[model samples]
Target: MDLPRSFTIRESSHRILNPFTDEKLATLGRALHLAPGTRMLDLACGKGEMLCTWAAAHRVTGTGVDISSDFIGAASARAAALGVADQVTFLHDDAASHAATDPVDVASCIGATWIGGGVAGTVELLRRSLRPGGTMLVGEPYWRREPPDQAAVEGSMATSKDEFRSLPALIEQFGELGVDVVEMVLADQDSWDRYVAAQWLNIRRWLDRNPDDELAEQMRAELTTAPVRYARYQRDYLGWGVFVLMDR
Candidate 1:
């Protein structure tokens, strides 16, 4: 009931596991005009940065569910540190099956659409937890440009180019689902670099301390090649953003 060991280790120091920076996250909260006590449900909520920060800044209260125990622990600690422990909660559970107990002002699943299979399914899953006129936040990757070939796709860690739609087509996807894309904030290449490059340093520091760990070899290989692969493909061809959606 957790993410792979490699993933947790690589992102051990990350508060926000995705490309969305703290500033971008704050901007998103402000853009939403969150009212005090706004109830939110964040699936795959990682370290619960959104809930904790929103609770502190916007006075929103929320629950975050993530399968990773390590992440859940960190999230709880974060809430406590922010002195918002009373406003938010984190549960270590499989988000795919964690049904919301109450309707919420917002339901979000960021960077983990696989919980319901894909973007459309994930959107429906979140929508089920929303109150009338409530919003859904979906963080997804889009193809910024057509990859030149298979190498580009593989380099971006995608099985195929079809895995992501272009930005315009992505909006159309929301249209197909009867939702309006009311707002969005995109991640630029610098943010992508910060998110991906930080992993190399984390792995390197861990390798320095635990040279004989079982995953060391895999981590070493990943660190060795990630920079080139990321700069060449992911930074240029992949675009990620969190879209704010509401029914039409």
Candidate 2:
């Protein structure tokens, strides 16, 4: 079973797919207090960069689950390349109904909450794979301030202005869900640029290689407009972050 070629291409280059830059990712790792022997599960783990790097750097053992086999293969290679093959595993699987092979210290569904519908639902979904006292890590979007216009919301990838709450409201929602927001790492403008702008180069290269592909037109449109849209709307009105949570 093959995903759309565009999806495969994006999955193959997730260091750029993600909205967080490498420095932000490292900051997140430190904020989570990830350590040796910590068992973790990464849902929607694109290319498993975070999992593999954390495994090697912190000596953590983890499993990364993604829908793309290409991502799983790349993740496996990354683990081995980092000499942490024994510590991390990658699987091509659906994450919506994923169950941990065993209870783990951390369960993460970063930047892909659609697997559980949305943020609150995703937290519940991650809870199932976590040990009694384990943490749930979610990377999600919020508003820097309430969007002043529907177009601004659309630019941030939401259908309506109500799709995401403001940052404090997002944290409060987690509290209402009975989870303590223990740690968080926010994405800065530069990080967002890295995530969105880098895609332009990849898309440009793809169009060069596969000029006749049907998706090429759509990607070209995105490439032409995304940078301006992102700068005008998302950069000014939206925010993104990864939160580390624990049961209250």
| Stretches > 4 Å off in candidate 2 | 1-3, 10-12
Whole-model lDDT for model 1 versus the true structure? 0.93
Which residue ranges in model 1 land beyond 4 Å of their true spot? none
Q: lDDT of candidate 2? A: 0.84
TM-score of candidate 2 to 2 decimals = 0.95
Q: For model 1, how does the per-residue alpha-carbon lDDT over 1-248 read when each residue is reduced to its tens digit?
A: 67899988899889999998888999999999999999999999999999999999999999999999999999999999999999999999999988688899999999999998999999889988999899999999999999989999999889999999999999999999999999999998888888988888999999999899999899899889998999889999999999999987
- Model 2 per-residue lDDT tens digits across residues 1-248: 42467776543455534778777777888877777899999999988889887887788898988887777788888888999999898988988889896899999998899999998889988988999999999988898878888888898878998788889999999999999999999888888877777777778888889889889888888888978998889887878999999998
Q: Give the TM-score of candidate 1.
A: 0.99
Give per-model TM-scores: 0.99, 0.95
Q: Give the alpha-carbon lDDT of every model.
A: 0.93, 0.84
Q: Please give the range of 10 consecutive residues that has the lowest summed lDDT in model 2.
A: 8-17
Could you tell me which 10 consecutive residues in candidate 1 have the lowest summed lDDT?
1-10
Superposed by TM-score, candidate 2 places the C-alpha of residue 170 at a distance from the truth, in angstroms, of 0.3
Best by TM-score: 1
lDDT of 2 at 146: 82
